[model samples]
Structures are given as C-alpha cells and as structure tokens.
Target: MRRALAVLEQVRDHAAAEGLSLTELADTLGLSKSTVLRLAQPLLDTGLLSRDRRHGHFRLGPGALALGQAYLAGIDLRTAAAEEAHRLMREAGGTVHLCVPDAPHIVYIDKVENETAVRMASRIGSRAPMYCTAVGKAMLAWLPEDVFAQVVDAGLPTVTTRTLTDPGLLRTELARIRNRGYSVDDRENEPEVRCVAAPIFDHNDVVVGALSVSGLTSRVTAARVRELGPAVAAAALRVSRTLGATR
Candidate 1:
C-alpha cells in the first residue's frame, strides 16, 4: 500500500509538469525500472494514470479528475449553505450566493434567486474578482495577514469607479468588515449591482467560504443594504453552526 501511494504521489507531481519516463520514475522512487513498471501497471489499468506510447511518458488520467470532482461535490459547505441561501433570498428579496475563495477570485458553488423581479448574473460555477465582490471581501477579511498580503501584492483591478484599487485603502475596508462581521460591495463589481456578505467558518474556526445577498442597486439602496447586512451575517452564522463551527 505504501509503495502504491508513493508511486501515485510521484506521478501526480510529474503529471502537472513534464510527464515522467518509466526510468525517471524508478530513479525518483529509488526502485528498479521493472519494479516501477510493475507498480504503475495497476494504476494505468485503473485509469488513475496514463502512459504515452509515443514518448514513453506517464501522466494522470481522467479517473483522477473524476475523483477530484467527486470530492469537491461532497464538501459539507455546499450542502450546509443550500437552504440558508434560499432563506436569505426569501427574506432579502435578492439573489443569494454561496462562494469559496479561489486565490484572487471567488467561485460560486450554490445560488438561490429571488422569485420576485430581481435577477443576478451569477451562476453556480461563475467566478468574480475577490477584491470587488462582497463574498470575496468577507472571506478575505478573515484570512491570515501574510496570505492577505500575498493576494493584495498580486494586484487589484478596477472593476468600477467604486472599486478599491489601492492596497492601503482595501486593508482599511477589510478591517471594517472584520469589525462589522460582514462586508459590502457598493457597486464595485458592476455599476448597478450591490451585495452584503458574511464569512462562514469551519469546525476548525477557519473561514471556509462566504454567503452573500445581492440585488440591483436601485432596489438595494444604502439604507436597505445596511438592514440586510446583519441578516446575511446571521444566516452565514447558521451555516457555520451546521458545519460544526465553534467560532
């Protein structure tokens, strides 16, 4: 079992870069070429790894991606937030999004649209800039300082006139978000859209994701936005509790 796991690990790294030759894999694992081939055969047959007949190189196959997708689909956060997102939409009269940080971006994993006249552009798999969305800012406000610095150093693009392009100013906003227990995007991502969001914590007290209520700025005005902030935060907290969060 240990040998099989080691072979998979070596192949996983090589598959992302230049695929490893059988002999190279043997050398990397300190095993004989025949032993490496023998260990890899089962993986190849199971579709976890694939070998090139033309170049004699080995890489990950479709089965690996299938397993990854399956794992992501089984994450508790998505299930925990599903009903809460619907509840938020019913109460707030806007679209509700459940998103997770993907480095400098936030990816929506679930959504519930208001049954009224409001409509939002986001879909289940849509992504948005982390610096310009309320869901992104909610998660970012809780990230460790070093990690937050890394994201800011990469670059913050201006999506609209209200977007915060300066790192110093963004930090100030994040601090306020941390204090308020939620974040707000005042037409930062789009000229006519606005959102309020709060972070969801995991059992480890780590911020695993965010939940946001979004709508057209005309309907979700400044006064209404303020009223929605605490509601969003409370809904997010409910999801955190369902995920076994203690913090």
Candidate 2:
C-alpha cells in the first residue's frame, strides 16, 4: 500500500506534463514496466487513474477529485467557509479562496473562480509565500510572534518586484492587517493581481486559516480593495462563527 501511494503521488506530479506513459512512469520510478502496470491497474479499477487506450498514458481521474472533495468536506474550516467563499466570489466579482497556513507558506485548499473574462492563475492546493499574499499575511498577523518569527527564519523568497523580503517591513504590514482586521495583496504575488483577505479563527480564538477575494487590478482598484476589505472580513467572521469562534 505504501509503495502504491508513493507511485500515486508521482503520478499526480506528472499530471501537468500531460499525463504519463507507462514506460515513462516506470523509468521515472526506477521500476520495471510490469511493476508499474501492476500498481496502476488497481488504481485504474478504483477510478483513481484513467488511461488512454491508444497512447497508454495515465492521468488523475474524477475519483481523485472526489477524494479531494471528500477530504475538504470533512474539514470543519473548509466546510464552514465553502458557501461564504462562493458567495464572496459572486458578491465581490472575483475569485475567492480559502487557505490555511503551512508553516512559512500558505496553501490554498479551496477556490471559487471568477466568472468574468479575467481570472487568476491560482488553483486548489497551490502554495504561496507567507510574506506577500493577502491570505498569508492575514494568517500571519494573528499568529503568535514566535511562530511568525519561525516563518521568517525559514527564508523568504523574492516572488516579484513588489514582494517585501524585508522582515521589518513585512512585520509592519502584518501589524496593519491586525489593526484593520484584514489584509491586502497589491500585486505582491502576481503582477496586476490584487487580493483582499481576512483570517478565520477557531473556537479558542486561534487563527487557523483565511479567506480571500482576488481579481485583476484593472477590475479591482484600490477603492474596490478598500470596499472588499470589510466585506471579506465579515464573511470570514461568519465562517469563524460557524466554527464556534466567539471573537
């Protein structure tokens, strides 16, 4: 089972490269073609992988997406915020994302795409640095200082020209987020993309995750960001309430 799972992860990694041929997968894993086929057969039966008849290529199937959805549904944070995330996408006229802190990074767990012609590049399970993104900063602002320090100690990568690699400046930005009850990403992660996000808390008033609304700067102006700030905060607070957070 463990070996099968390891191969499964490898298969997922190869999905963006237009799936993987059986020979390609075997070569990549340093395993025999027979061994690869044996492992892939059970996954194919379970609908975890789909194969092309002519090309003999394997790719992630609908069952994999179902597994992801099931996992998300089982999480209280994602369950509580799912509707709000969708509603915010409609209300704010942009993409909505729910993210959780993964140490020095933030991982997007769910996203509601914008309906307009313009859209963001982010997808579910995508990751971003803790220092630049609105969702990252929103969670960072409420995290314990020691934990926040640990994140900074892990090396902040320069993502873009606007990314704040300076710890002092980043802290100052987080402080403002704490004061205002929300965070904003002004093309720090992606050029011409701006985002507004608010942190979500648990029953213990511990920050566990965040929700964000993002769009192209041409559509989401500074004034629009200010307008969406409170809206996003309110929506996130509602999700927090569902999770038993009082404050």
Candidate 3:
C-alpha cells in the first residue's frame, strides 16, 4: 500500500513538472505502460488525476485541489482570523476573503465562495490592485499619513476606468475610508466587481490585515454596499483583535 502511494506521488510530481504521460511514466519508472496505468488506478479512483485534457494528457483533477486546500487550511494563523472568516461566510452567504500584505500586492490567504446561484471570482491566492481594492484600501487607510503618501508617490495606475486614478481623489476616498473604518471597491478593480472590506488590528492596535466580502456589482448596489461595509469591518476588527493585533 505504501509503495503504491509512493508511485502516485512520483506520477503527481512528474506530471506537475512536465505533464507526465503513459509513455513517459513507463519509461521513467521502468514499468510497462499497462503497469503504469494499473499503478495509477488508485489515484484515478480518488479523483486526483483526470483523463488527458487533450487526447491522452493526464493532469490534475479536482481532488488535487481539495488536497492542496486541506494542507493550507491545516496551518494555524498566528491568530483567530480563520474562525471569523468561516463565520462571515456562513452568515453572509457571500464570498469572504482574508488577506495579508505580500509586498507589491495583498495575497488572499483564504476565501470562501458563496454558494449562491450567482458567483464571482474570489479565489484564494488572488492578488489585486492595492489602491483600488477594498482590502487594500482598508489596510492603506490605517497606515501613517506618510505611508499613505508613499503609496501615492509609488504611482496608482488605473486598473479599470472606475478605479480612482487621481492620487488626490484617492486621498479623499481613503480619508473617507478611514473615517468610516471601512472601504469600498465600487467596480474599481474589475468592471462590475464590488467589494466591502474592514481593517484587522493586532494586540498592538496596529493594522495587520483585512477581511472582505465581494460579489457582482448588479447584486451589491450602493445601499447593499453600505449595509455590508459595517459587517465586514466588524468581522475584520474581531479577527484582528483575536490575532493579538492592537491599534
């Protein structure tokens, strides 16, 4: 059983590296193509690999994604943000995101997609515009005024026509965000994409990350945006404090 599992790992690794095929696996593993298939049968049963996307190109399947996400979910954040993320998802029935600063952009560390009839692109690991995105602005609004200036000086390119391209306009918007303790995307990143985000603070009361709920613009109107803003912000603050973040 252990040996069989090892063979699957070899196939997965090789496939990831260079699209493993029957002939390749047979030659590399010194087994017959038939033998390779027989050995790979378990992974197929587990839905880890799929029939060649093209004629005979075996590749990863949905099960592989599940496994990867499971691994990610297993890691404990230095705080309780994940619990908040789960709660937000359950309560809102909309996609919830948890992100952390990753230099050039914020990295989506976690995402829970809404099970609604309508959906949006809210995937984990997605990187988005720092100036125009809700989570980005939420974090940005809490920074020192000098740091905010630095972000402006760093150049805020227009991602979408609706994105606030003028640094002065952005400054004003950020000010509003700071005042409200929340931020709005308003289709700034992608056309028809709307998001509401709130800043997360650690034990030091310092802003560390943010949380958000995003959906299509058609679904999230101005009033709905106003309604969700406080919820997302509250959730973020709750999680931030749970993470020992204070400000």
Q: Order the candidate numbers by lDDT, best to worst.
A: 2, 1, 3
Q: Could you tell which candidate, 2 or 3, scores higher by TM-score?
A: 2
- Deviation from native of the Cα of residue 40 in model 1, angstroms: 52
TM value for model 2:
0.69
Candidate 2 minimal-lDDT segment of 10 residues = 68-77
Could you estimate the TM-score for every candidate? 0.69, 0.69, 0.64
Alpha-carbon deviation at 135 in model 1, angstroms:
0.4
How well is each residue in 1-247 modelled by candidate 1, as lDDT tens digits? 6897798889887765878988888898999999888888888888888888898898997888787667545668888898888888889899989999887889999988877756787888988888889999999999888767777877998889999999999999999999999999999999999999999998678998999998898899999988999999999999987776767
Model 1 alpha-carbon miss at residue 11, Å: 47
Superposed by TM-score, candidate 1 places the C-alpha of residue 37 at a distance from the truth, in angstroms, of: 61
How do the residues 1-99 of candidate 2 rate in per-residue lDDT, one tens digit apiece? 876776788879887787898888888989998998898888999989899888888899888979866754566888899899989998988999999
lDDT of the candidates, in the order given: 0.88, 0.89, 0.76
| Model 1: how far residue 39 lies from native, Å | 54
User: Cα RMSDs of all predictions?
Assistant: 12.3, 17.0, 16.3
Candidate 3 C-alpha lDDT tens digits along 53-133: 576656676898788667546544533677787788777667888877654467787877767626666677888767888
lDDT of 3 at 226: 88
lDDT of 1: 0.88
Evaluate model 1: give its TM-score.
Answer: 0.69
Q: What is residue 153's positional error in candidate 1, in angstroms?
A: 2.4
> Once superposed on the true structure, which residue ranges of model 2 sit more than 4 Å away at CA?
1-75
